[model samples]
Target: MDETLKDSKKLISDIQTQYTRLSKGQKLIAQYILNNYDKVAFMTACKLGETVGVSESTVVRFANALGYSGYPKLQAALQELIKNKLTTVQRVEMANDYSDENTILNKILKGDIDNIRETLEEIDGEAFQEAISRLLKARKIYILGMRTSFVVAQYLGFYLGIILDNVHTVRMDMGDAFEQIVRIGEDDVVIAFSFPRYSKKSFQLVKYAKEKGAHVISITDSLFAPIASESDNTLIVKSNMASFVDSLVPAMSVANALAVAVGMKEKEDIKEHFDDLEQMWDKYGMFE
Candidate 1:
């Protein structure tokens, strides 16, 4: 990891610090990136150069001038910088900025596919295994999500609960969410879900959980996410725009994969638990 990859650090600061030393073209690229960082992260060097009316070589040189080994590395640093910094308005504007591309459905689907691919690239396998290990070993686990992220939390909590009896979800809508989380302790684990247009309330809940000394695992879009900064383990997934809604396909998939991985890790016990659940569900006709 490079110095610019620090989640808590702002890449804009680096750009500004080097402003006096940059060439005219380099300054142009830096200014454009600073202005449209959220959009620039997803664009290619060619696209960025075209947008700024510069040659691709100029962009590459600009990245080198910024102390990055290459354009892709510099792009990654910029992405890490603005990953969770965009406001809802910025997201809508960035989405509209690219609205001229393909059909709506095609764009949305392609975006989802790209999100999954980016998630695979950004996510760390070792961290994933560590999360599964910690989750399995925790005395109790609490999961929380707000807004669209809540659906993913619910899905993960539901399956995780079916496998482990100590799983709990802090449902804010039910009004007792804090009551459940107020008892979080050293042996407890809290898994939080957050995405673009991140919920301040959900992040507050994560803070509260941390205050109570629970180890937190954050599933979010970027390392720069506030929740990630607060978490014991941060899983940076990818979710791009799909019309007005935030594309949570990759986030949901990450949750599902984590749940399944945990299940596989405790296969024997989980299998027995599921066998009983299957019998009970069959007896009660829970599914048609």
Candidate 2:
């Protein structure tokens, strides 16, 4: 689990439990959050303090009082509370509050940059190397991600398939998700992509893979995420919300890194495979 994470529900409960002991300004801040957590989840410390009619310092103190390292960790706890619960309409409403047309481009790009930065800073290097080792040794690899997560899974599967054989990208259109992975065994590896609005189908498949003795690797936003719990190796890549959509650039970047790293390990074999592929493509005129 992310050492930075406080249980979302417990955080709220603690706030209520300590309401009577809070200073007058802290009580106002707590009251605002208690009633409007969804709104506060996306706010900056300065913005939250301003909304509560208090100085930003008071907000930081309030977060510290709640046992968080700082205001950002507290804000992140609040975000976890509503991450899966927020509807698309609610996300769009939040987008309106956070950005305008004039600033949308910069705001979204900045958020994506921050996501990558945090992912790079917080992701476990040892776990990442271990995941690569597992993939290299696996008899077969299965990849699954539903909804928006499918985009990331597809991208990773495409590259990994080229680098290594027997890579399966599970798609619901082909059959039931369970059927797609039913043959998983101890020698197999299942890489699951899970992000905000986490997929129940994906989580179930990952759990099933674990039960069948397959190695599980999860590329997700947090270690506390459902799929992460089932994974043998959890790759924590940040996907902070950017407007109505979850920012996926960070996840894609990591996927690319993984593919490249794996490809480099089998460089001679891949070179020969690509050479044959190029000849076949030339004979068929597959590309202009």
Candidate 3:
């Protein structure tokens, strides 16, 4: 475990255990930090205070209450947590001066490598394998994502279609989503994605899918995310970032792994399909 993450986990666990003892101002700071750990990690004391409607002194007091020497110490700890949690592109962006391209490139490369390394470390291999198995066995797979996460849904739908044949990526059209999900049944599986500032419509869709007896799989940043509570299995992807935009690299990687696992599991079937495509490609003179 990264030392920073270890500290953060300790802090969070401590806060949860002793929450009732916190002062009102301290509780506000705690809630803000817990809800927006990435933002708090990167923000200045003045900025965090402004957002939380608290004074800078209060922020410092809150840090002290958490057993830190002061606000800067707490900030340093948060920076480490962010570094451990954020994606490569995100961390690079955080670290860069923004005016220097060469420096930015180096940082970006380092961040990507670190992101992949940490992702491998954080993922529960057994749970992931079980998700793949469930997906493979499902009679149909319904992928649900909205807003930024829709890109993930589309990618999964496209690749999984080549292998699974019964994959559906829900469109943004609300009526269409309702109509499609209504038809899902007990043997179907629903994979839903939502993150911080999660979509209400996505939650509703997950609920509807569950009501229809489909197994729900959720990919989200928080265990407390509304969708996670209802999911048959939830894959937690760390989406924390310095800026407003959340990174999708981890989610995309998870989706890719699922597609590959499913394809490998049905290798004989996929091989026949690809073999037929190869002959068609030769016939059409599609490639040199």
Which candidate model has the greater TM-score, 2 or 3? Answer: 2
lDDT over C-alpha atoms for residue 62 of model 1: 88
Best by TM-score: 2
**Per-residue alpha-carbon lDDT of candidate 3 for residues 191-254, written as tens digits (9 for 90 to 100):** 9988656788999999988988989989876556789878888787766543445567788888
What are the Cα lDDT values of the candidates?
A: 0.82, 0.90, 0.78
| Model 1 Cα shift for residue 29 (angstroms) | 3.1
Off by over 4 Å in 2: 1-3, 98-100
Clashing pairs in 2: none
Model 1: CA > 4 A from native: 2-4, 7-9, 34-44, 83-85, 97-102, 241-243
TM-score attained by model 1: 0.83
Candidate 2, residues 1-288, lDDT tens digits: the string is 553564676888999998999999999999999999999998999999889899999999999888888998898898877787888888888877555675988888888999899999989999989988999999999998999999989999999999899899999789798988899999999999999888888888999999999999999988778998898888889887875788999999999989998999999999999999999999999999
- Write down the worst ten-residue block by lDDT for model 1: 1-10
The true-versus-predicted C-alpha distance at residue 207 of model 3, in Å, is 1.1
Ranking by lDDT: 2, 1, 3
Better of 1 and 2 by lDDT: 2
